[model samples]
Target: MDMTTQHITLGAINMEAENPVELAAFWGTVTSAVPSVGGGTVYLPPAGPGGFAMFFRPMAGPRLERQAAHLDLTVPWGSRQAEVDRLLSLGATYKWDVLDEVPHVQWTTLADPEGNLFCVAEHPPAS
Candidate 1:
């Protein structure tokens, strides 16, 4: 096999939710993705280029523990607070905020209705 011929790209991130449809609705609103159902799963296609789709599956039982990973959403500098507030209005619970002096970074943690954690951060745009 030619090394250059091999390419791997992320297609989607799968999550288990007590109610897949509801969870998909929350995510769909957040990411501006349209949700569809097929094969007993709720699927949210990527909203734009370089974005990965999301698949929400029905959970067999209540969440047993903290999720192993979470997502970090970036916003243009000075917009983090407004975005966080918007998410709160959308049913996301505020967790906490973190500010790093050395790197001058700031982020706020929040949980979706199902308690899946994610973050919103403000950072300088690419030069």
Candidate 2:
């Protein structure tokens, strides 16, 4: 395999929602990513360079089970709680909080309006 001859980049993270426009709006507000709509789908451009965009499409039927993957958003040290609060105000519901003393990390799990899970985390500064 010639690894150097082939280039691969993450294009987007796609998900299904009952209302794609509303779901995209929630994520767009949370990540500050502007959205573009077309072809029955809503796309949010990456928040910054090298970041992958997010795409939301209409669901054909009710989701029967929890999603196997979720997004974990990192915030500056000591800001996880505030970010979680802000997300809640923007229509996210609290799931739980994980505070690990072994590594001294904190993160709060949350679900979007449509029940998609995600997290906000704060990590210790590099020593």
Candidate 3:
């Protein structure tokens, strides 16, 4: 087998949610992804090649443990704060903010409706 062909590529990140519809809607709105449902699963298609599709599975109960992994979203320069605010208004709960944690680094940590932690960071616009 060719070494390049054997390399793995991420397809999607499956998340457990008490309500797949709501969770899928949230992610769909954030990413502007097209949402689809079938076989009792909800999916949000990837925004681009670098992005991965999100799959939401219905869970029997509320999330009982902290998430060991989380999503990090980066916005264009000068848009991080506004994006955070918009997410908050869209049902994300604020966790904490770190400003100037390191030179030119600023971010805010937040949890989704299901208490899954994710971060929003600012990055320089693509040249």
**Candidate achieving the largest TM-score:** 2
**Which should have the higher lDDT, number 1 or number 3?**
1
Clashes per model (N, Cα, C within 3 A): 0, 0, 0
What does each candidate score in C-alpha RMSD? 2.1, 1.8, 2.7
Best by lDDT: 2
- Extract clashing residue pairs from model 1: none
Worst ten in a row by lDDT for model 2: 1-10
Tens digits of lDDT, candidate 2, 38-82: 988999999898666899999988896868899988889988888
lDDT-best of 1 and 2: 2
Which lDDT values do the candidates have, in the order given? Answer: 0.89, 0.90, 0.85
Please give the range of 10 consecutive residues that has the lowest summed lDDT in model 3.
Answer: 1-10
Off by over 4 Å in 3: 1-7, 60-62, 124-127
What's the TM for model 3?
0.84
Check candidate 2 and list the clashing pairs. none
TM-score of each: 0.87, 0.89, 0.84
Better of 2 and 3 by TM-score: 2
